[model samples]
Target: MPVDLVPTPGAGPRVTFTGLGGAELIIGLTGQSRQMSRWALGFILIAAAGTALARRGCGSKVIFIVVVLTVASLLALWLPATTDVANGAFMAGAALVPLYILIALVQRLWNSLFVRNM
Candidate 1:
């Protein structure tokens, strides 16, 4: 069957050209979403970090969470942006989950290495 071979445009803000194949070429991206999700995810990240930091006498877990979340939000901001509000926001938000888990691992390692009582 013939693949849906769409004309891939040159590099720009919108979709990027991947490559040509035997029959059809695939476009890496299609659009850009500069608004909408940006503010939403930004606010959520701020609130989450604020809340994590606000807790009094934060333990190692809290410190780890705050640092991890903040880093995740930062990385999310760096994620490749798509053409749709949903896509950009989704990619940004999705990028944070694994970051949080990594934070947990780092905290555990720190605890074992430094804080023996923890």
Candidate 2:
């Protein structure tokens, strides 16, 4: 790689260190490849499960399932061994409900305010 094309080692960290979550993510990623892999795997599985449930005509139950998963992930925090998986699980489980609601709200508002005559 050309020297100009390759970023300096400190350049990336400098930008990431400016934000709280970015800094933590950068710090957590250092020398923790295994834990990061576990987190990613867990997140993918949890998200897939949620999507599967939603696709199988379990529309109403999806919210309940996500809530349960979120709670379980939170409880998993009590045990150090599960923390990595739980962090990813919690992120997946916790984001769905609010995101769903936000999208629905936006659609509703758009329909009510800007959608043309029906």
Candidate 3:
């Protein structure tokens, strides 16, 4: 499998490959470095707020469930405008269950460290 390196302006070279059906696929080597940082910041902020709320005697389970459901619902509504409407909405809505569980565990961990009265 041979790849072609194409230099990008102000960044490293990206990889270009010929795929099935002779389609050209360009993989950016330097363009997506900051993508995870943005989402990490969002999760950090959410965790901080959730921990603070837990310390203040707020219900962690309820908060996690509500926040996950609200965000997933909003994503479901917003994604349809950008991509395949039905699939986008369905994927976003379907993500609610896993996101809810993951966030619940994170909330519990934060609460365990900050909230002493468990």
lDDT of 3 by residue, 75-115 (tens): 64786332233333334334444655676689889989998
For 1-118, candidate 2 gives per-residue lDDT tens digits of 2223356775645432455454322123334898898788767877787665553443664765667586666667677667777778777777666755666678779989998986
Winning candidate number (lDDT): 2
Q: How does each model score on TM-score?
A: 0.33, 0.47, 0.34
lDDT of 3: 0.52
Per-residue CA lDDT of candidate 1, range 7-103, in tens?
A: 6677456654666655454446332353555646554654464445432343644554556555655565675442233333334445545655566
In model 3, which runs have C-alpha deviations exceeding 4 angstroms? 1-30, 58-61, 76-118
**Each candidate: how many clashes?**
2, 0, 0
Tell me the lDDT of model 2 at 81: 69
Which residue pairs clash within candidate 2?
Answer: none
Candidate 1, residue 83: how far the Cα is off, in Å: 6.6
Which candidate number would show the highest TM-score if scored against the true structure?
2
Misplaced by over 4 Å in model 2 are: 1-30, 55-59, 62-71, 102-118
1 or 2, which is superior by TM-score? 2
Better model by TM-score, 1 or 3? 3
